[model samples]
Target: MDIEQLIALIDGFKQFPQIKRETTLFDIGSRGHFENPMTEVLSFFCNTTEVHGMNDLVISSIVSLIRQNAIYESLQYAQAHGKPQREVTTKNNKRIDLLLNSDEWVIAIESKVNHQQINPFDEYEAYVDSLIRTKKAVNKDNDLTDETEKQAVFVILSPDGKVDNVHLHPRWCGISFQQLVNEIKKRLQQHFFDAPFNKWYLVLKDFLLHLENLVNDEEQNSAQEEFVLTHLGEISQAWNLLKNTLQSVQQKAHTKLEQHPELNGILRSQKSSWFGLPTTILYSKDEMTEAVLFATGVPSVDIADDDPRNAGKHIFIQIHIQTDDEELELESIHESLANKAVNHWYSGGSKCFRWPVNELSIEGITKEFVSTFEAINNLSPLSLNK
Candidate 1:
C-alpha cells in the first residue's frame, strides 16, 4: 500500500474506542513477573484455613473446570485431606507449582505464566502415581470398606488452555486462567457478602482483577492476531512502507546533524537506546557529557506526559551529563534549560534533560538539538568540556 493508504488505515484504527484495563495491586506488584506470586495467591485461597474465608469454594470451582469430573466431585463434596501445597516436590525432586490431595484423589497442578509448557510432566505423573499407590496400600492395610478406587489428576494451567508437550504424560489436562477466573466469579457471587469485613476478600478481589487483566490481555492479543490475519496483505504493505519512510527520515536527520555548522566537531550519530532510531550525539570537550537528539514517528497519544519525547511534542531530545565530574553541577545545568526543556531527571549516575520540539522536520530536530547543546555549554562551560 502507498503512504496515504497506510495513514488512512492508521487513522481508521485510532478511531476505535480505547478500553483501559483497571490497575490492581497485583498488577503493580507482579509487573509481568506473575508465575510464583500467582501460584502463592491461588494456593492461599484454595486452602480452607486461609483468611479468604471462602474455604473450598475457590479450589472446587477450579476442579470443576478440569476434565476429570470424578476428581471435582470428590474434592467439592468431600473434605480435602490437608492444606494445598505450593512447589510440592515430586519423586525426582521436580517441584510442582500446586498440589491438592484428598483421601480418594491426588491432584498435581503445573502453573505457567508466559513460558511454554516444557516441564517434567513424567516426573509429575510418577509423583502422583506414587501417591495413589501409597493411598491404595494404606486403604488395603486398614481394610477400608469403601469400594471407590484412588485417582490421580495432572493439570497444566496457563493463560491459554494449551499444553505444548501433552504427549509426555497421559493424565495431563489443560485449563485456562480465564476459565478459572470465570468459575471463581460464579462461585464468589454466592459468597460475596459471607464475610463483609474480611480483608482477605479484598485480596481475593485484587488477585481476581490481576487474573482478569492477564486473560483480557491474551484475548486482546488473539483479536489482534485475527485482525492481522484478516488484513495480512494490506498490513504487510503498510509496514514495509512505514519502515522505508522511517529509514528515509533517519538519513535526513543524520545529514542535517552533520551539516549543521555549530555542531561541526561535536557531532556523532548512533542508534538510540530508547527506540533504536538514529540519534545525533554532540560530545562535550571532555567527551564525558553527551547531548542526544532523535525524531520518533510515534503518535502523540501513545507517548507518556513525562516521556523524553515530550508527550504531545513531535521532536525528542535528551542531554546526558556524567556524575563523576566534580566540576559539573547537574542541578545548575538542569535549571538553565528548565524553561526550554519538557522534563529533566537523574538516572544511572547521569543527569538527563529533554527539550520540546514543535516541528516534525529534520531541521526542526537539528535546531532543538543545537539550542539545548548551547544552553548546557553556557551553564557549565567546563562540563561539556567543548
Candidate 2:
C-alpha cells in the first residue's frame, strides 16, 4: 500500500458536472468590498442609532446569545437612544469587536475566525475597567462597583466558540457563528411589520443568508458521508494504503527539509503532526509573518480532477501568508497571487497560496515546493522587476 495505490483507488470517483448560474449584485459587491463579510454585517447589527425598531431586535438577540438574562431584562427598560458601538478601542489600545452600552448593562465581544485568542481575557477585562471608570466619573457617590452593580458580559464569538480554557474568566462565555445565525433566523420569522425598517430587515436577512452559506452545509456533508459508507470496503482499502503513503511522504520530506537551504534546521517533531493525520510544515529562515510552506497528504479530489494534471492524490504544497497587523489586509495580497501566479490558486477561507502537485516523483515534488518557498521568501513590495 502506497500513494500510487491510493491514487488508483480514488480515481474511481468521477468529478461532478459543473452547473452554470448567474451571479447576483450582492455577490459582486461582496467580492470586492466585503473582505471580512461577517465583520461588516456585525457592524450593521450593532448600529442601533442608524435604523429605528431594528435595533431593538438586534440588541435583544445579542443579549440572549450572551446568556445575560438580567441584562436582557434591563435592556427592556432602557431608552431607544442606547446604541451599540463597533470596534471600540480601549485605553490599553485593545479593540473590542462589538461594544453594546446601556444605562443598566454593557456587552463586549471578541470575534475570531479559525484561530483562538492569544490573550483571551485581557481586552475584555480592560473594557470592564473602562466601564467602571465611566460610571464613577458620571457620579462621585455612585456605588456601581461595591453595590447595585450593572451587568457586564464578555463574549468570544467564533466559528466553533472554542477558546483557551486557561485564560478564561468566570464572566467569559462562548457563542458559535451557527448559534448567532439561528438567533437571527428566529427573529426574522417573527411578525414585525415596521414599515420604516423594511430596508434594514432585507439587508440583515441577506447577511443571514450569506452566513448560512458559510456555516450550514449539513446536507452536503451527509451526502458525502453516505457516499463513503456505501463504498466502505473500497475506502477501507484506500485508507490502509494512505497510511503507508503518509509515512513514506513524511520520511522523504523530513530528509529533504533538513538539507534544503531556505527550510533547513527544522526538527522532525516540529515539522510533523499526528492528531488529524501526519502532515508536515515547511518554512523559510524568516518566520516573522507566520508564512509557511505546508506539505500535507490530500486524500480526495472532487472538481479538481477534471484536468489530466490533477488526476492523482499526493502531497499538497500550500504557501500560506498570515499576519496579525490590523492595518495590513491580506485580501489584496491573496487577490494578486490568485490572478498572477503561474499555477491555479484559490483564496477564500484564509490567506494562503497553493497549486496542484503535478510532479509524480516525491523527490521532484519536494524540490519544486522548496524553490517556490524560496521565491516567496525573497519577494519584496519595492521590487520593480517583479
Candidate 3:
C-alpha cells in the first residue's frame, strides 16, 4: 500500500472508539518497580490480622481459587492462622516474594511482573519443608497428635495463570492476577457498601483497579503488536515515504531562500541546531547580527494529528536573533513582531518568534521568511546594525 492509502486506513481506524487507559495511583507511585509494590500491597491485604476488618474475606477468596487439591486444602486450613510476610528468607537464604505461615501450614508465593519464573523454587520448597518439620517436631514434643498434619504449598503468581515450565516443578501451582481481581470484584460487589472499614475498602478497590489496568494494558499491547505485524509492509512503505517527502520539502525551502532577491546578499543555508532541520541564516552587512529561520514539522513530524504542520503538510517558521553587540535591545525587536507573529519568547540571550504557514511550498516559506526578516530589521537597534 502507498502512503496516502495507509493514511486513509489510519483515518478509518480513528473512527473506532479509543479506550483511554487510566493512570492509577500504583502507576504514579511504583516508580518502575511494579512487582515490589504489588507484593507489598498483596501482603497487606492478605493479612487477616491487619485493620482491613474484612478478616479472612480477601485471603479466603484467593485461597478458594487454587486448583491444586493439596495446596487448596493447606491454604484453606491456614486461612485463619496464616500470617502474611513480605520478602521471607528461605533455608538456603533465597528470598521468596511473599509468604504466609502458620503453625501447621506454610504458603510460599513468588510474584512475577514482566519477568520469567527463574527463581530458586527448590530453595523455597526446602524452606517451607524445614518450617513444617520444625512445627511437627514441636507438636510431637507437646504430644499434640490430635492436630492435623503439617503441609506446605508453593504458588507462582503472574499476570497470566501460567508458569515457565510446569514439568520443572510438578507440585507448584500457577495463579493469575486476573483471577484474583475477578474474585475480589465478585466479593466487593456483594459486600462493598457493608464493608466495616470504608478506608480499607477503598484501598482494596484501588488495588483491584490497578491489577485490572495492568491486565488490560498487556492485552492492548498484544493487540497493537498483532496489528503492526499484520500491516508491517504497508507501514514500512508509508514511513519511508514520509522521510523522503520531509527531505524534499526542506530542500525546496532552502533553495527558495537561497535564490530570493530580498535575501540573496544575506541569506546563508545551514543545518539547524534544533532537530537538524534546514536553516536559513540572514546576516547584517557587518555580520555582527544574524536572524536564524528554522523550519519545523518536517523530518521530525509533530505528534498531534490535527496540527497543520503534522506529517510535513505545512511548515512552522521559527525565527531567532543572534547578536554579538551587548547594547542591542533584543526584547524590543521581539515586541515589534509580537502582534504579527504567532508566538514570541526569550531563551538563551536571544528572542525567538514563530509563524505557522499553511503549506510547505517554496513560495509560502520564502514569503514568510522575507516578511519576518524585514520586521526584525525595521527595529531601531537592528536597523542601525544593518
Candidate 4:
C-alpha cells in the first residue's frame, strides 16, 4: 500500500487505545499483563486483505517490528548462507544457526527462530580449524597482527596480500537484500540459462551433500525421504525454491520491521549505527484503548505499573522470546486471534495486558534498537579475540 495508507493504518492503532473505559477503575483485580493489540489487528486484517499471498511478509513484519535483534542474528547465520558452529547458552537450548568462512571471510550466525538442534558438536562442526578461526579470529578494532585474531566487523570486500593474515578480514561484508539479488543475478547472467541451468549448482551442491547425510541419518523416516525426493530437481532449482521461501520470509520481516517506525526507527537512523533493545511500549490507557480499537488478537502485554485504574497511564507491549518456529498464522488463525482479542478485554473498550503470549524476537537494524548492534558487536566472537 501507499505510505499515507500505511501512516493512516498506524494512526488507527493510536485511536484504538481510547475506545472504552474500564468497568472497575480502582481495582480490576490484576489488569492482567500488558498487550500490544495493534500488530494483532494488523495481522488479522492483513490475513484477510487482498494481500493474502503476502501474508508471511506481513506476519514477519509484525513479529520483526517486535523482535529486531533476533532477526539480525537470523539473517547472518541462516543455514542457506553457510555452515554454523554451535555455542553454549544457559538461557535455554539455543544454537548457533550457521557459520561461513573462507581464507578471507569468517562469519558466525546466531538465530532465534528455527532452532533445530541445540548442540551441534564438533564433527558436527564442519572444518574444525576454519570454525575456530571464524569464531575466534574475527574483527577487533584495537587488534594487532601479532596473532591471527581479527575483529568481528571485518568484511570480505578487501583482502590482505598475505593468505594467513587472520588479522585481515572484510569490514561489514555482510549480505543484504540487494547484495543477495546481485549475487543471484551474477550467477544467472553467467550460467542460469546455460546447459546445466543450475545457477545454484555451486552453492547448493554442498547442501545436496548435507541432504545425503540427512538421507543416511538413522533418524530419517521413509516419508521424509519421499518428501525430499519428490521435491528434488536440479540442485539449483531446489536451492532457489528454498532461497525464495527464505527471501519471502526475510522480506516479510523487513516489512514487519517497518511497522513501528516512530519508535523502532529512531534507534537506527544511520548506516553504521546499531539498534538493539527489549521491544517495549510507553502509553496511557487512551493509547491502549487506541491500540485495541485498531489492532488485533488478544493483545498480550505485561503491566509495567499497576496504579489507580481511573488515573494512570497504562503502557503496553508485545513480549519477545527466542525459539524455534513461530506459530504459523493462516488467514483463519489471524482471524480467530483478532476475534479472540476483541472478546477478551477490549470487549467494552477496556484495555488489559496478558503475560507471555507469543515470544518472538527479530534480529534487525532500527533507530530505537541501534544500541543493540554494539551490544551484539561486543558479544561478537570476532571482537572477543585479543
Point out the worst 10-residue segment of candidate 1 by lDDT.
Answer: 138-147
lDDT by residue for model 2 over 339-381, one digit each (tens)? 3232333344334544565665655655555445445555322
Per-residue lDDT of model 3, residues 128-206, tens digit only? 6765666442222123221345557788877787778877887688888899888888887777577655688878888
Q: How far is candidate 4 from the true structure (C-alpha RMSD, Å)?
A: 28.8
Candidate 3 ranges beyond 4 A from true positions: 1-17, 29-33, 67-77, 80-83, 136-148, 265-346, 350-386
The clash count of every prediction, one per candidate, is: 3, 0, 0, 64
RMSD of each: 6.4, 15.4, 6.6, 28.8
Range of the 10 consecutive residues with the lowest summed lDDT in candidate 3: 137-146
- How high is the lDDT of residue 23 in model 1? 87
User: How many backbone clashes are present in model 2?
Assistant: 0
Question: Candidate 2 or 4, higher lDDT?
Answer: 2
Best candidate (score: lDDT):
1
Off by over 4 Å in 4: 1-94, 110-174, 193-195, 198-386
**Residue by residue across 1-386, what tens digits does model 1's lDDT show?**
66687787787666554559998887674454468888888888888876667878887776678744333444434556567777776656788898876655667888887777778788887776776665433222133223145567788788887777655555677888888888888888888666565788778888888877887787777777777787788887876664554455556545554454566534554654345444556666666678876555573443455555465564466678777544444457646465664566677777666665676554554445555666666632212112
Count clashing pairs, candidate 4: 64
Q: Please give the lDDT score at residue 74 for candidate 2.
A: 42
C-alpha-based local distance difference test score of model 2: 0.54
lDDT of 2 at 113: 60
Error of 3 at 67 (Å): 4.1
Order of candidate numbers by TM-score, starting with the best: 3, 1, 2, 4
TM-score per model over all chains: 0.71, 0.46, 0.72, 0.19
